[model samples]
Target chain A: MIVAEHKPLKELLALVEGFDRILMVGCKGCVSVCNAGGQKEVAILAAALRIARKRAGRPIAIEELTLDRQCEPEFIEWLEEPVKKGGCQAVVSLACSIGPQYIAEAYPTLPVLPGLNTTFMGGTVTHGVWAEYCSSCGNCGIANFGGLCPVTRCAKQLLNGPCGGSVDGFCEISPETPCVWELIYERLKNLGQLDRLEAILAPKDWSTSLSGGPRKIVREDLIL
Target chain B: MSMKTNLKGILEGSGFAVLAAAPAVCGTDLSAVSDFARLLKGKVTAVFAADNPGARVSASALAVSVKLLAEGVEPVLCMTTRDRNRLALESDLLGAGALGIANVQIVNGAHPSLGSHPSAHRVYDVDAVQWIAAATRIASEKTLISGEAVSGDPSFFIGAAANPFVKTPELHLPVLKKKVAAGARFLVTAPVFDAARLATWLDNLKKSGVTCPVIATVAVLPDAATARHLARAGRGMAIPDSVIARIEKAGDKSLDEAIAVAVENIQAVKALPGIRGVAIIAPGSETAIPRVMEAI
Candidate 1:
């Protein structure tokens, strides 16, 4: 899931300071699951902004709304009714970065602002903890390393094996981070696939990854 | 044809090879190179120039290698994978070859987070083994990793780093063997403080069929404080407590004691099987190198 965190209240407040009234939009997708940009968070942010504005002696208004998913064009249309009625001068998106981009495209006249910082594509490690699991490198070759992606896990993204800095199964970067190559070695050894590592894994084709440039995909089968 | 001077030729000869690591060449000063050459001209085989030791930014190893070459000393240019991608690495190698710098040491550089610029992004486009293989291709096959032909020969006497202290030889040995297979002519190791561990690693190397000559590194600690720091820092390079205690007990003679310890390590490592030479690393100074070599 796409993980994100709320922007500092001060920064968000400054971003919307020019506008007396704004529409704060939230998402019910990954942002909601991560407890970052959801319906409850939207209400809290709206109330906080109201309080902050009222304290400044310039009481502003905010129309709060949460979409099923801001990334889909169909769900983005749901904002039309509230935005039309609220007379909101700007839109604030509390979803992952995708929400604001979609909202900006949908409502070109109003200024779109981001209320949260999109961090990484990751999954929840615990109830309140999240860890990055993939880098979306386009090419998936985890099967070669017992289902572990060194491209995302290893600090250096070493293809062949661990570097000399691996100490006691932990990376030299921090004791908290387990050296992923060591983990791969252990996993492969347990599976009796140690011989698989005998062959040197070649340098990755990074052009398939982010190194190539901004990426895009079009499915001919699904095209109109 | 190979370059006029190369580490492989020196190591392949009958005598025990001695590599003196020059102090970090952080600027345009070639006086250190001349001084180092004058001090160890007849005594050493090659001068090693490290790339960003401690991950702190320093002068290019190729630039230092050029200085060593000018002083009539063979230079081993240490190249790290952390700083540049395959294109830049290949370009540097080609440039080094043109400058008559033949010996190249490939290492997975220390993480940038551990360096002076902790927030700097690292480009490990190719790991050490992959780069070693790519370098070998650029040298021997006259082709790039992309299979592009070079206009001229860019030969190199390739070397790779080894860590004898890794707890998991199950994984380390295969990579070492692969490095040799990928055309690393020699293997230089991290500083060896534990002879037993080194011997075990050597035995494993032999059993794994990696017959490349191993050059053990022996670092000269200037004081007990540095020893304590290294031991506490936990950078994965081991410095035994006994050795640290010995240095600490020396009081004002800690520098001498450190040199003596390095001498002892050199002698001990030279006696072991598969050991071909020792690279003396005297941090912040090359004065200890001559003393360590003379004592050994």
Candidate 2:
């Protein structure tokens, strides 16, 4: 899922400056699952921002609301009433990076401020610990590496590793992070698929990735 | 067991010779390197290809090798898979070969984080072993591992590096085996400070059936400060305490002591059974090559 984290209160306060009334928008999709830009976090940020502004002798008003998902235009339409009718001059979007853009496009006049930093598309590895597992290279070939993604996991993104610097199954960058190739090796070894490590895969076609710029997809059969 | 007392003697009967590593830095003075290489033109066998030494990206090694080859000097190109993917590597192999550069050393290289551009994403699409495997395939079959046909065979004299000072150095035998099996024609070890450690490592390699020609590395530090810095920054270059004390006590003559120590190391390393030659790495002290080689 897309992962994001709330911006620091200091930065958030600086972003909403000059705005007397603010609407805090949250997302129930990826942000909610990651405990980052969810409804609960929106309330916490609203309260914190209010306290910070009040302490600064410039008390402001904030309204909290969450949508099913902020990236989609249909879900973004839900914020029209609060932004148009309510006294909100600006919106603080606590959703993935795409949220603020969608909100801005929906309410063109209202200032849409992003309250979260979109980190990566990853899953919660453990409680309160999130690790990036995919590079979203627009190509998925984890089946070849025993289900481990070197593009995101290896510090060097080595297609064939562990490099000479790997120590005790740990990456050279940090001991805390387990080397991805080491994990792949163990996984391949266990599955009796070590021979896959021998076959040199060709260089990745990065045109499908961000290198090729913004990507879009349309299914002809599914299209109206 | 002192086989040779000088560089000339060291290269007298062996297939290898002392090659100088011309490290490329952010603002590398290539003229100075060219001058150094010229000074050692006939004195040494060849100059090492600039493999982005010190992990800093500089002029391509192939460019340097081509330049040196034009000057009638052999160049050994160090190809680290850290910077390029398989396509770029194969291209470089073919390019180096076209430039008449034969020797190529494959290594996983230092992590890009250690280089000047720490933020640069490292592309280790293939490690040293896999890279060698591809190179060997390109040599015999004239085809890349991807089955892409090349115009001509690179037939590179494939070399790989090993660090005997790493933790439980003997355990690296399996890794050495993999490299040799992949395609390493010869091997070079990390700089030696403690000969005993390397001896044990070599013994283990032999026991494991490694018969490739092993070239020992002898790093020359100019002073105590350099020694300490290398010890801290280098991956497997641990300076022995005894050698450190000797350097510290030498005071104004520390460089002389370092050279003497390096010479002594060359002697000790040459005595080892499996070691076929020595490679000298004296970055700031390139002049010391003549001195060390004079006594090799």
Top model by lDDT, which number? 1
lDDT of 2 by residue, B23-106 (tens): 453454567567667778887766787688757878888877776666666777889988887789998888877766778889
Model 1 chain A is weakest, by summed lDDT over 10 consecutive residues, at A158-167
Which lDDT values do the candidates have, in the order given? 0.88, 0.79
| Per-model tally of clashing residue pairs | 0, 3
Q: What shift in Å separates residue B92 of candidate 2 from its native position after superposition?
A: 3.9
Clashing pairs in 1: none
**Global local distance difference test of model 2:** 0.79
Off by over 4 Å in 2: A9-14, A17-21, A47-61, A87-90, A104-111, A123-127, A137-148, A181-224, B1-14, B23-25, B85-91, B133-155, B165-178, B207-210, B222-234
Best by DockQ: 1
Angstrom error of the Cα, residue A207, model 2: value is 5.9
- Shift of residue A101 alpha carbon in model 1, Å: 1.9
- The residue-by-residue lDDT of candidate 1 on A102-209, one tens digit each, is 999988888999999999999999999998889999999999998898998999888888888888889888888999989899899889898878889899898978
